[model samples]
Target chain A: MAVYTEVPDDELAAFVKAYDIGEVVSFKGIAEGVENSNYLLATTKARFILTLYEKRVNRDDLPFFLGLLEHLSAKGLTCPQPVAGRDGEALRMLCGRPAALVTFLDGVSVRRPTARHCAELGRALAELHETGKGFALRRPNALSVSGWRPMAEAAKGRSQAVSPELDAIVAAELDHLEATFARLDLPKGVIHADLFPNNVFFLGDRLSGLIDFYFACDDAFAYDVAICLNAWCFEPDQSFNVTKGRALLSAYHATRPLEPDEVAALPTLARGAAIRFLLTRLVDWLDTPAGALVKKLDPLEYLKKLRFHQQANDATAFGWRP
Target chain B: MAVYTEVPDDELAAFVKAYDIGEVVSFKGIAEGVENSNYLLATTKARFILTLYEKRVNRDDLPFFLGLLEHLSAKGLTCPQPVAGRDGEALRMLCGRPAALVTFLDGVSVRRPTARHCAELGRALAELHETGKGFALRRPNALSVSGWRPMAEAAKGRSQAVSPELDAIVAAELDHLEATFARLDLPKGVIHADLFPNNVFFLGDRLSGLIDFYFACDDAFAYDVAICLNAWCFEPDQSFNVTKGRALLSAYHATRPLEPDEVAALPTLARGAAIRFLLTRLVDWLDTPAGALVKKLDPLEYLKKLRFHQQANDATAFGWRP
Candidate 1:
């Protein structure tokens, strides 16, 4: 729930003049994305989203994010297409921040996603990966296996404050994942590194759109699947629901068949996914200044998820028997 | 920028089932109002605003606020009409908070309002006061003249933290306003006590709608005018712009002719209005828990406005003549 910068009327009018979209009808700050300021912008022609990139987003990586959306939408994906100005530039400046206008996708994010929603999301995820094949830009996933150690070390001693045994569990998991990830040869491609349910929208029971491509990068496709498993298949009790896991994996497999090695690597990738979130969240939980605008998600939630992943011996444990 | 309560999907689906409005298409938390969790709800029929009243609003006062909106809309004022459910109830409990669905009003709020906008707002405000006459439900202005002292007392000694002489200015203004308000007899009616520019919507220089009636109450109509004058007729540098003041007053007077007494009391009411905000803002500044979600407005801004009002001797000083 943030609108850190207020856009003045004159400045907005001037900014809209650069676009081919008709006169601005209405604009409102949307409390959806946490990483940037998002506004539901309506014009005489159509509704769009106006995003002002905040400090958390690296300015250099914006073209990759914007370009990926353009590339995906062009490949028949239901995503926000970056609307270019009359000069054909999608990115511009507004309120002294990097800004862009994208066509609005019509759907609501499902809060408690069912197996059916997970299935639809799985199909969409596979479509995103397949569609992303043609995109030329490459950004390595910063939160991948290589990134975990530094984050875990930063939160190493302090993680016990969250829970007495958290530090030891995280340390053991880090060692296991680091050793396993270094030796794996897996199918790699563009992946929506943070394809959580909140970033996927549903119109009725159908997946209408996928959004918030900020965390997207070039990474193992199985890693993206693992992220979805952690995000979508878990219940309130932190127990993994195998039925939903099977639904997500089978739907994803139907779209793009996983290789034998990729299937075998699922459990390890899922463990890495859990630790990736757990370590980052743990660091954020400790580092966030008290009373900051953003709410720090509970790191212990991912700790519980990591514990579940630790027990899984094979891909069959995740309902994938490839 | 507030969406305090997360309305789960199952609960929202069940809640919307009671409404005659079409099936919900999209729901996004809007970063707009501070006092409530607002969502821009789109259905198959049309867009609507879903407001979940937060703790700042008194539960007992819900009917008055919702009723006033209904009453004003029925009287032909362009404002958000509270949408009644199939059971003919506009108010219901959702996510354990008093909630309501109101017809979405179009148009954007101008950050910097022009005199033309001020004139339109003036006419809309007069229309609101006239329409509100038919509203039977009455809520007293708790932030009016009498409410200032307790708040002033709470922030009295601590006021100097905002400004060096704020305590002295507030003390002097309270005594003056207390004495002046006791001796006044003016026309009283329903007044939108917090008619800031953000609460008024404009579409291409035309006033499209008025909103946020939480502070609407039974008070001297001129006091509402004074609040607007304090809100709208001031420049960024804190100097009063008499051209905008004249435009606002004359337009308002054209719609609802202010009685000689109401006109004569304008300067004093404006002074009291400044102090009213100053005292409340000062209290909020002092009492707000550190790191709270809402941003505490600067009390010194009102202190500056209070100083401007202290020198005005008559209605003519506010660009009005009895």
Candidate 2:
């Protein structure tokens, strides 16, 4: 299930040599993801996560992914900075694939976070989004309408579980979104497309660091907030816990009060986001390889999310009341 | 991005030989999904969708996927019926994969479904769950708690552009999700796993057909209804559109009112649905291949939906006051 290439110890050692930190004393592959292979490398002076270039990752986009990490880290964001290689570069070739080593963050991710933690995450997400401005690169939202339908096509005809009504709803929602959000004056900037609960790490009630920059790209700032609202505030059963939802949103608002335009466009953004997940999950569901340790996620989950977003009109539920 | 194999004309013809349907004069690939390869097959007697099996589908589970189609068709559920091949089998080898032919449905998905449509679809979904009993096959929830951490691990250690607070929130949420709802009374039954908006087609405010059944499997029935609530209700934005939510849930309740046991589990089911989406979208965000038309959806949208379900502790939002 390791999607990406595994970073080599020797290569990571070479990158560590380039850093202003310490000597590489240890390194090992952490076989976990379906994207990039990672190794926890400990140097004489510091710890780092050595990443191997996985097939799914675009080598060309390494600078964007790694550089953004450095940029955000330098801007006082509590993120792991990608270390420059021997060529005085963050991007480098390793094991015949693009690879890099990042500063190892402290503390394990909280397996159980409270409402206070949710609120803190909300505010922190706002801060990171605020810092993502003028991030030196411009990329369109990768999961926009133009990007969704095609994926849905890949998994078509395999599963009869997806009601055609759902497909129609997606098509119709796409059109509505195009018309509805086409005119919004929402501020545009870099946003984290995947702000799920596990992508973050906390040290007690305080946040230690944020990991996984693979989905960072130019898009709406509010979208990032919405993602956070969706990720951090849910109850155990996956329902929207208003107490946590409000706390998270309120924290986010306090840090970077949403612009009226961004606030207004939330419903549509929510739908767009929902459709995006539904399609990806659907594709995954239909294409899970045999003997793959990876579990196929239910596409219906996001379908429901999109359906709810479709019905969403009260800004209050989002805890961003006018 | 076609995830599966293409069904050949000869193969389509072979598969339809035993069915009561007419000749398959033509079959054209409907290049849309990333899960399965779908072809619009037309014959002198009827039009149908010829699906070629791909990796995500298990050959052993073909009976469930194919049989459910036939079963629903028998019950007058607006679904595509599986056509047997010359060998007297609904599933046959074609294009080096398992393939089947289904009667193509009539009517387009509604762009702007009326409240009645929402209610009707909800009721239909409930009825489908009711009828789903004794469905001869069962599969556990594919995107349950056991699936979350692995997905998170996939995206971990990859430079995130998130703030410390955001990281903490994610860690905390993961913990909470793992601790709670990790185990619950799962009223197992056949439930459609991907009931998105576009999967249903409507003709004049009535649900003409419910297409796509590849993801139908065993799980909590209320979770299915919760999925409907999330999908049928909600607007494009993240706001809760109570009216539509009400109509959809009410209509569903009218046909197959939720059991108190089901209602008790609604909150958890909603959360499960939300997390199911959050994880898949997160994985996609981290792993989409280059040149793959698939887009990574925002994980937060599900996070928001989860939040709403968390808030919906009572049956009011679900339109089930009883």
lDDT of every predicted structure (CA atoms): 0.88, 0.68
**CAPRI grade, predicted model 2:** incorrect
Candidate 1 chain B, poorest ten consecutive residues by summed lDDT: B313-322
Instruction: Give DockQ per model, in order.
Output: 0.66, 0.01
Candidate 1 versus truth, CA RMSD in Å, comes to 1.3
lDDT of 1 at B212: 89
Q: What is the lDDT of residue A47 in candidate 2?
A: 61
TM-score for each predicted model, relative to the true structure:
0.98, 0.48
lDDT of 1 by residue, A197-218 (tens): 8899888899999998999999
Report model 1's chain A TM-score.
Answer: 0.98
lDDT of 2 by residue, B1-322 (tens): 2324534334444566667776544333443345777766556677677778788877888888888888878887878888775566888767688778777775445444567878778877887887777678767766767776776667566416322233344455577767766766656688887787667865546676787877788877777777776666666676666777778777777887767777777666666677677667766766765444354567667767766776776666655566
Candidate with the greatest TM-score versus the true structure: 1
DockQ of 2: 0.01
